[model samples]
Target: MTERESSRYIDATAADWIARLDRGPLTNEEAQALEAWLAGDPRRRGAMLRADALSLLSESAGALAPQFEPTPFAPPAAPPPPGVSRRRMLAWTGVGGLAAASLGVLAITTQPAAAITTGLGEVRLVTLDDGSTVMLNTQSGMRVRYGDTVRRVELLYGEAYFTVVPDQRRPFVVDLPGKPLRAARGTFRVRKLEGKPVDILVDQGGVWLGEAGTADAVLLRANTRLVLPDAAGTPLPVPETISTDHVSRALAWREGKIAFEGDRLDQAAAEFARYSRTRIEIRDPALAGEPVTGLFAASDPAGFGRAVASVFDAKVEQRDGAVILTR
Candidate 1:
């Protein structure tokens, strides 16, 4: 295809198609057309997914911005038959809050900055104007600031996985607890657990870790996990290497599950609490260090409680919005 032809159908067209699909069940003709368009170009599918996901997230958050209608692409050579006119096309494609996600995707892309937060047991996916995507885990918050020179994000709390689309001129930087993590092209996960060290896990590409003001930095490559120094500024005794299996286990939360490998019972309980309103308490200190293994739903507090109780024959009590276990 010629360069002009390739550039003719861009993300804006894809976004319009996404808006249409989200509205309602489409006619077979429309459906076939969409499928053909998607199959025609690989990039089109990616654009549609990003736009649709972003719209969903905005809808879920109860904040849909005003509709943004870019200039519609030039109408085809021949107008549609009797019922299906270009006006009908707009009607089918117009932003409808209930029919599908609308307004927010356009707003986020054009706005200078935005902030997002997810409550307990909630996961959010965001598509930035730069075309990067971010998945926010439960109880996480972040602020995005985009400019001509940089695309910046401040991870206020909790964990987020960034799938960055490279922009060589504008570097993507994530601000964590102690240092700034920068990437031009890559996917990575950054986590900030309460009272724990900030963790950076690189799944694809690489990240530069360093203070916000200085030039000194550490380059961490793919499949590597780095745990920064503790609050006391004490580094690890030795460089820690995380295995692929362990990385997968840590990221299991993305799938609404948690993997435990001989994790302390108390520690496991704490992790589960992040995804549920009901808290877990171990009354007996002796049982706090008990080993726990296997995979379980992040929000299944009752199931976890029952499993623990059956294993240790411990007493399980349901208190005011909390679960207490003891022997």
Candidate 2:
């Protein structure tokens, strides 16, 4: 086959893959096959990106078609017939004018940004275009913005754990109210709660905390935790090196459980309130300060309250959608 024919074949294959992805996730076998095909030729990745750009453009045009009136001289263009090639579709849609180098830019820019939210007691997992996954915690909201040079997510409220895929060209950055956290390849968790300082934990790889392309950015490595002050110009504390066990306990919310290692009763109750509508009320100051340690279901506030009361030889009362403990 001629070189042109080989290029056309690659583009067609890429178009088919994009279509499959649009329908839904590919099966494991299909995913493996796609990996193998992409590994076979470096140019195939570029072709895939171009095809993806054309597909996004086509979808956007179709969605906006009803809003615009056709030109007086030009009647509405008819849809392409069955078996019409993606190349022909691009030409018909006037996307052929786009330069090849700009395909990646167009693909990222033309797509609309998405805001993902989770309700109280809800945990959601989101998959991005580049295969990175964001696991949103309870009452969390995040906005996704993919640009030509960077993949950015703004954590508007609540907590989320990000498992970012490595892209040296486009660094993955998660923005909080304060400094942005940037990573090339890493798994990290960021929590922003009301009246509390932002908490960041790096699990698998290192993440830079601060503005991008700046020397002042602090790198938080694996098993490191940083508590960022909410007030601007507050002296930043050193990133603390935490044990693996601490990381696991901190992340127990991911598994629908909350782990407490000698946490005060009031602190544990407040943590439970973040996960459940059923409140745990400890009226006595002494009882509230009692130390509690264990793993308990996040959703079962009553069960947790009962266990605490039993251990402390206190009384348990259910009232007005709350679990109360008293001596």
Candidate 3:
């Protein structure tokens, strides 16, 4: 192969590895193969990181510019045509160069607002201009709006954990649809999963949960959780005090792990689905109902399946890109 042709081939291989990693954690064989490929060429590691960063930048730009539905997680049915991957990689190079050049200037300016989103199985930590930080979970979206009067953020969808800086003149407010959560200095988490009530967990200090300028706002204290109502007039449930252990388990995703305590087998499967394209199917109703308790890697559905199979005396089958459990 010519020198340029060989370089393009390496870029294509790196892109393929990144796409596979985005789908789910690699199997043992795939992991070993990737290690071998990297060992063969030192440039391959840098190519992989470059491809991944460019891909993330592309996805972020697409998310902010348009209102389009995100593609659901699914295994790749077939490989791309020859040279297609290389062409895509070449295209990213130009875009990535322009983006990198502009990022430094954008960092220093005061932007009115910015939209951010994370793709499937991706976790991101974003630091705001006001010295606060936000950790976004998988498949999450939000808009950060910092103004002269207040630091406001809109949770468009999904979940985020926030650590707010103490600014008495400008309170930090998180807008959840119609409800607004306000705090001056605190650490908290807000989850707005589809088909479920908005969940608010305060880790340190306190926050006011209600509409802005309202007199009946509820105060949520530290180490407490509240399941806010979806409907406008529905009465809010009292905030429940949570233990330190519970907080650690609930926030386990920060470390790319899922912690379960006597959760149903099917429920755990659904939770894992959020982080991987590999579906875990429970064929037997009895097996699906069995209680499970453990901490598992979020990206490794296949490994989780093996663990469940060993514990329940079930069989684990890999077929059509899914992990099926049978008894």
- In model 3, the Cα lDDT at residue 70 comes to 19
lDDT tens digits, residue span 195-300, model 1: 8878888866777887544645777787888888876545433225667667667776655667788888999998988888899989999888888776666766
Candidate 2, 95-145: lDDT as tens digits: 221212111112122223677777777776565666566667788888999
User: Cα miss at 33, model 1 (Å)?
Assistant: 17
Clashing pairs for model 3 are none
After TM-score superposition, the amount by which residue 20's alpha carbon in candidate 2 deviates from its true location, in angstroms, is 25
Q: Tell me the TM-score of each prediction against the true structure.
A: 0.66, 0.67, 0.66
Which segments of candidate 2 are over 4 A away from where they belong? 1-112
TM-score of 3: 0.66
What pairs collide in candidate 2? none
Whole-model lDDT, model 1: 0.66
lDDT of 3 by residue, 1-327 (tens): 644337688889988887876566556576667767765654554455456555554432111111222122233578654432432332222111112111111121222366887777777666566546576788888898888899999988888887665667898999976678998876788999999888999877789988656776889998899988778877777899998567767876765677788889999999988888889999999999998877677777787888888778889998887999999
Q: Best-fitting candidate, measured by lDDT?
A: 2
Better of 2 and 3 by TM-score: 2
Each model's C-alpha lDDT?
0.66, 0.70, 0.69
* For model 1, the run of ten residues with the poorest summed lDDT: 95-104
Per-residue lDDT value at 200 in model 1: 85
